[model samples]
Target: MKYVVVIGDGMVDLPLKELDGKTPLQQAKTPNMDFIAKNGSCGMLQTVPPGMAPGSDVANLSIMGYDPKKYYTGRGPLEAASIGAELSDDDVGFRCNFITEDEGRLDDFNAGHISTAEASQLIEALNQHFYRYGKFYLGTSYRHLFVYKKKDAATLESTPPHDVVGEPITEHLLKPENDPLAIKLNELMYKTSKILEKHPVNQKRLDKGKKLANMIWLWGQGTKPQMPPFVDTYGIKGATITGVDLIKGIGTYLGLTNVHVPGATGYYDTDYCGKVNFALEALQDHDLVFIHVEAPDEAGHAGDIQEKILAIERIDRRILGKLLEELPSLGDYAIAILPDHPTPIDVRTHTSDPIPYAMYSPGCESDKTEAYNESSVENSFKNSSKELMEGYKFLKFFIDYSQCKKA
Candidate 1:
């Protein structure tokens, strides 16, 4: 049986008064997602475990059947894997973000979703300037990797720029009590800011009235991770399709095939239809295919409620709609759809909320869920609580519903 998992990253949200107290998922036109709920079993899946930070790295690992508490080292090493960067036993990798700063305040975490071409140039300049401390390698857009040639590099306490949008950078800068690496990282960020402020890229961006990619924010540091191959974990050949390096990195480390779709950006303008087409082709040989869409999450981070609704609608029409129409030709398949975590529009960051999920396996008894949303699954179906089924176990239960059904 073919297993398909589509992750709408950070698509879940709280009710908003703007939409008459209805969430984006509740109000958006998601007929395809609704159809999955109508035909299959629906429930809530706590992607983030208790006492864990609700980052995509931890959450997606749980969703993919790997216990993050055991397998997760950090976000940096994961992205490093996507870029094919080899880390030594003592070396540590860091997720270096190109950010925009204004008047000592953190302006934009994404540097206005900077293009890969422009960001590559900026990363090259940073490497040229700071060749002594560490080396920077370009990933995609603002997301890049920095390999620090030191063992204690992971101990530095740094905050994610997304978590401190509009806050003073001085308040959130890296704080290391006695660690010299942390002090150098903080100094590098400040020095990079001054250099990039005078660079031609920022000058052109300023002239064009675009947000400048003026500073480097370092966080999410870790060493290499040890994970079994996807086949060994599930006893099935699987592949992953995503626009973000973090997801691709996880897939890479697990020895899963990473399918790249042209024009797949980790933003609202990402190619949803392209991802759908690629995933369909991947399922021709693979037993399982995992597709991740980052648009809804980007919208949530921007607090663009309408854009989030539009993103969900696009996924329903361009991705899920096409999948349901074409999967019948492939073979007997089970499709699971849910978000990794909630990037609530109000909070504008990841939250530790149990996300709603739906799984449609042929011949499985439907729980009579009519719509797919935060509230519908709770009210209409008898669902499993986070206390009952952990996120890492959800995949095992999804792929082997017969065994789980009897248990």
Candidate 2:
């Protein structure tokens, strides 16, 4: 089976500072992607809907032609279920994060780049002490993947209390103010902190000149997803290569395997070559490969435009370049690469705008474009989402329109 490899970092788009300012793609050097966009079909895609609450989770589903409202139960359980964590009809799931909380004020976020092991230990410790019918699962360190179930609906109403970055976690917490059932969350938060404070793993890392994993704050609490399995719906197996817990969790929830490679970094400084290799190999074992990179969004979230550009450029050369180089050897497969959403470096938040998108079928179009952006591809025949779906109508038509082909 031929596979369409979707390669791009996870979402967290920016509100481009200047109306006419260059996009991250325009600013970054993406020769191979630019070449693909120009050689084949390209256009502006509103991967997310016209007016939907935006997130990488929803954008990806939309790009794949799944309606967000129909498919997204919530992103948390998908990530949770990805890591072997399970949820039920009565259960609630949340994305818990081990961000840097101040030891002095306990107010600051971004706890100095805490490592995953420290975060995992903290979650394990938190997991050890659960009262009644609630459960918390730790994922990839920075993300605390949690699930809860109560017999009564009242038990699940309280939600994760996070509004903006750097908001006092103390002020925004599981409380009666937000949820009557939130009384026990602050206890869990304090417990998770104390456990991290003395964790031998953290202490050992600190001794090794590594950042100490500190506090955890819960956010993105959501319900379990109900989307049909890809194999069931698309007649093809799918797998993802990513470190971000939510995407991994989603892949897991959908029963998609998370690809692991030798020398895999599992984070921003990840091995880009390793990711492309995973995509190429997936062609043999599966029908679709979802290669999710996290660094660009991380850079954008950090307000580091230069770093975001570097991440994009680096991936373009290392990951995207390697994939294209190997394409000739692996005949008959098409490549479609698009971002789940725009991660504008300066703004560092998910923005609702049509992003530049493209698809490349070998021998379809021979000319490579110099760059990739919104306005470059509208003049071509590959004008709609259906035309861009790599010979399948499953994505753009929102149904089983796979009775025909362009290849």
Candidate 3:
């Protein structure tokens, strides 16, 4: 089995923020990441198309070589698969977000930051009410990824009402502009909210003096993923190390095993050292290990450039640096570092610009002089594969082509 370790911020950004001064990456002191770049072959990656929503869910799919256009059914259902919610062929999956509803309008997206347990309980109650025919899965944080299986493919979709947070909940599902199924979804959203307002979970939280889980935001409707398992693609049994349910959900959906480790948090301050070791361990059992460091992206989204740098540096010093030092002793392992996409702190969203990436061996060396900007690694890369390619192209990066039969 061959080993390839992909490490970096895994989010393709939308050009939401204007380029004013030096980008956040340009300003950070990430010696470790810089070390990896100088020691490896560098290049760029575009994980999403222009003008599409800036979501890592789709972008990560692209990086794994799954074309978003072909595989993205919607964000929620893909996540639903990871949570073990079986969806029907016809049933659509929608990403359900927990939000606050004030006078029928989306007030805030996170529903007062309702605790994950509260979120899970609220979903259970919603399922108890509507799951008579379909499926509902509540995950960590205030996310509910759902699947409506065998319902007949339909063209209906909805997300949290945009922008204005404190207005009356809008009738997103019932609009005539959408397919009749969307109208049904809207009806379902309204009913779901009403039931949630009094859900036993919400009631329990409220009774316990906690915030009530009140509303839902939905987006990204998708069918199940249709691809060979990673093992089939690269001869390495696939395993993943992730703390966030979103990434975990991706692994679960893609038929990869989740290697859970103690002290791993799926948040900005997620343990870097712990995450790195987890990936290294997976290498013993499998050939490909997708190690995700989500903090830099999170810091950028928060628009805190300083925090973003710190997050970047933290991973570099703690994770990438150590990996580089141990390469010689690790035998035949290959390491590649690249951002999934641009998550710039300046605008607090994803960007469309090409991200700088580099692949390095144990003792290779180079002369890139920048820390984290895309410019540093541009010279190292030669071929630009437009967007992302799944399986075949991704696998070729690993096993020598001589190992494969002609197509």
Candidate 4:
């Protein structure tokens, strides 16, 4: 049987008063998602385990059937794998983001979504200056990787830039100020600001009234991860289609094919149709294909309610809608739709909330879910015997639910 998992990254949200007290999922038209809920089963999935930060790395790892608590090393190592940056046992890979620092505060996490072309030049300059400490590898846009040789650097507590937007950079820099590694890294961050401030890239960005990627924030550090191949764990060859390097990195470690689509930008303008088309092709050889979209998550980070709604609609129409139309031809397919975590509009960051999921396979018993939304799934959970399933368990449940019904 063909399996398709469409992950609308950070697609779920809390009810917003501006959207008439309805969450984005409820406000957006998602007939394709609703159809799955109506014809199959719906329930909540706790993608983030207890006491863990609700980052995409942890959440998606859980969704891919690896318990985050057991397998998750850090976000940096994952992106490092995606960029082909091999991490030695003593090397700590860090997620280096080019962010906007204004008046000693973290102004923007993404620096106005800097272009990859501009970011490449900055990455070169970083390598030139910081070769003694580590080397920086360009990934996409503001996202990059830095591999530090000292394994102790991984123990330094560093905060995610997105989580401390508009906060003092000093307040959020690598913690335990007495630690030599933290002091050194924090100094490197300050030095980075001096180099980026005078760079031609920043000058050009200032001229264009765009946010300057004026400093690098390093966090999410870890050594290489030891993960069993996807086939070994699930007995299915899987592939991944995503614009984000983190997702690609996860797939790389899992032995899943990272299908490259030219138009998948990991932004608001990301090609939704292109991702689905690539996934469909990958399915010709793969047992399961994961289609992950980042636009909705980007909108959530920006707190753009309308854009989030638009992204949700685009996923429903351009991705899920098309999948529903074409998957019938592929035969005996089970398709599932869900978000990795909730990037709530009000909170504007990843939350440890149990996101909703809906899955459909031909002849599977339905739970009588009226629609695919937060409210509907909450109601379904209240009425049904199914507790909120762990994120890692959802994959197995999705794979076996249909077979058990047919039996």
Top TM-score model: 4
Clashes of each: 0, 11, 28, 0
Global lDDT of each model? Answer: 0.89, 0.62, 0.62, 0.93
TM-score of each: 0.97, 0.81, 0.81, 0.99
- lDDT of each residue in 1-407, candidate 1, tens digit only: 78889999999899999999999999999999999999888877777889988999999999888999899988999999999899998889999999999999999999998899998889889989999988999999999999999878787787889999999998887776456776788889999988898989889999999999999999999999999988998899989999999999999988899999998998988999999999999999998899999999999999999999999999999999998999988878889899999999999999997888888977776786979998998776455432446788889888877233344
Candidate 3 overall lDDT versus native: 0.62
Evaluate model 2: give its lDDT: 0.62
Task: Rank all candidate structures by their lDDT, best first, as comma-separated numbers.
Answer: 4, 1, 3, 2
lDDT for each residue of candidate 3 in 1-407, tens digit (9 for 90 to 100) = 33555545633233333434555565556676666566654555556656556477767776665666766666766677667777667667777777777666666565655777767777777888887546677676766776766344334544433333555566454334456565556667777778888777777766777655576666667676666566665555777776666677677766788888665555566788887788777777676677777777766555665666677667777777777665446566666666666765545556556666655555444445344456555543543332333322443553342232222
Off by over 4 Å in 3: 1-4, 7-20, 49-54, 102-107, 149-154, 160-178, 198-212, 363-369, 378-395, 398-407
Local lDDT at 239 for model 4: 97
**Cα RMSD, each candidate:** 1.8, 4.5, 4.7, 0.8
Which stretches of candidate 1 lie above 4 Å from their native place? 381-388, 402-407
Order of all candidates by TM-score, from best down to worst? 4, 1, 2, 3
| Residue pairs with clashing backbones, model 4 | none
**Could you tell me how far off, in angstroms, the CA of residue 257 lies in candidate 1 after the best superposition?**
0.5
